[model samples]
Target: MIYLVEHFYSIQGEGRYIGTPSLFFRFGACNLKCEGFACSEVAPDGTVVVGCDTVYAVNKEHFSSQWGKITKARELLNILELYELPEKSVDIVLTGGEPLLYAQDEIFVEFLQVLHQRGHRICFETNATIAVNFFKYEIYKECIFALSVKLSNSNEPYKKRVRGEVINSIATNAKDAYFKFSVDAESINLGLEDEIFDITSHAPSADVFCMPVGGDKKTVEANTPMLVEFCKAKGYNFSDRLHIRIWDANKGV
Candidate 1:
């Protein structure tokens, strides 16, 4: 059974598809906790506390009670129908604490088939650690994969998070995929260019997006200038965390 986190409609705020109206499905259970990069906190009284920038769906300890259980594929499809808005064609964004952790190829392929039949676009926001053999399935042809590669700044051990082989496989197989990197000024100062070049060496065809690690407007504002300068110097595409800027880290935006 798949452990679903949350599903809602929101604008695609990061990566190449920024500012697009889309339906977001946030699945639970991440392979990586991303400890240092603006994470939830724990209280002295044993309560799990989160930062102001985290979305309710992502702050598992606080919001787990409200998550819906979606067992059958038909039930998930029905849920998609309920979130369909008027006037704009919707794109389905499958995100996660790590959605791929729970989703198997068979279930995802079947779901993709149904969504494709109805003319819906599919986008997978992945951490690029899991080796998804999407080429084996027909649904692979109809999806846009956004491979967000975590860097050293995230505080996740390299062995646990950055698997070069798996990332290479996705870049080699996926029809359309983009490489997005999360960064901060310190990371850039410590030589983000060399790290980015290493990533680009693997996925040469993928478009690179460098997004500032912003959880609030203040952080976003603080990081923007340095990120812009870094991007200009290195010739990388700069991305702003628009949802956090507009909503100030509000959930389900």
Candidate 2:
């Protein structure tokens, strides 16, 4: 069964595909806590519920009851039917909580095959830690991988967050791929350059993109200029978190 946190049709808000109208499939479960950036709210019962923007997708225990356990491809496809596409072709993005955690999954792969056959352009927003066994699974080759390699700002240990083999696999096998790093003043002050040096040392040719880390328009405004200059000076691409600017990090894009 494929575990899904939520799915929606919204414009691409980050990376090279920014501003493109697309469908998003957010899979549940993640390998890293990245607890430093957790957000919270008070429920009707006055319970303090805390999590990241994708907290429901990350901490399964907190949100497990809400997850959609898709046992069949048609059940998943029925959700896509709501989009009412221009044709069978449309841009589709798979995100997470680390959607690639199911890279080796059988039912998920079957669903991917059907999607590919229908001409949907698939994109995976991944943390670049889980290695794709490309030799066994050919569906991965049909998708574009937008790798967001974690940095010290996430507060995750280096070994758990960055996996060289996975980055290498995505770079070597995906239909196309690029690197996107979440940037903030804190990340820059904390030797983000050093982290980049380590990643690029291994995968030097990958196109690098930097997105300011923020939850709301005000915060995005505060962080954008620094990230822009940082990207300009370093010759990397600057990405805008358009979704936050448009909706202030609300649920369902």
Candidate 3:
């Protein structure tokens, strides 16, 4: 079963393809709880939930009512129809909580195969911890991957966050892939360069893009300067959290 949290049509807000028109399919469930990033929200029962910006999608116990259990590829295709998106013009981004967690699921694979058959460019926004067998799921070979791997700033242990073999597998098998790290002033001061370098060593050929760590406009603004300079010094691409800047933490773009 595919547990979908939300779906939206919006411009790509960060990474290499920022500002591109895209349809997002945000799934629930994740391998890591990045509490260190510190974005929080209140649950329906008034519980103060905390984690990454998309905590609603991550804390399933708090937000399970919001997740849609999808059992068929046709349901997703029907959702796509509502948008009436131009034929193959908009990109398809499968995000999370950790979308790749369903890589081997029959329905998830069927959805990807259907989209691939229709000539859409599919991109998975993943943490790079879950590795897929591209040999078995050949359709994934033609997809793009935006590897948003968690860093030390996420409060996840190094071993849990950094899986060298998995990173290499995605980078080598995907048609196109890149690394995107979320950084804040504190993390940068704590020697983030070395951390990023260590992670990138696993995929030397993939390009790196870094964005400031923030779930709101003010936070993003406060961290952007340091991140920009850090990127300048390290020759990494600087990406902005454009959605937050434009909508100020509004959900669903």
Which of the numbered candidates is closest to the native, going by highest TM-score? 3
Q: Estimate each model's TM-score.
A: 0.89, 0.94, 0.98
Q: What tens digits encode model 3's per-residue C-alpha lDDT throughout 1-253?
A: 6899989999999999999999999999999999999999898888889899998889989888889999888888888888868765688999989998999998899999998888788999999999899999998999999999999989999999999999999999999999999999998989798999999999999999999999999999999998999989999999998989999989897
Error of 1 at 30 (Å): 0.5
lDDT of 1 by residue, 57-126 (tens): 4556566765666666787787766864865458888887676765454565677789888887888888
* Candidate 2 per-residue lDDT over residues 1-253, each given as its tens digit: 5798788888999999999989999998888777655455444445555645566688766567768887877777788878776764778899988998888777788889998998889999999998898779988898999988888777788999888987987898889899988777767767777788898665777888899877667777888887888888888899999998999968796
- Candidate 3 Cα RMSD (Å): 0.8
Pairwise lDDT winner, candidates 1 and 2: 2
Residue 9 C-alpha lDDT in model 2: 89
Q: Could you tell me the TM-score of candidate 1?
A: 0.89
Model 3 misplacement above 4 A: none
- Which parts of model 1 have CA positions greater than 4 angstroms off? 41-46, 49-63
Cα error, residue 90 of model 1, in Å, equals 1.3
Candidate closer to the true structure by lDDT (higher is better), 2 or 3: 3
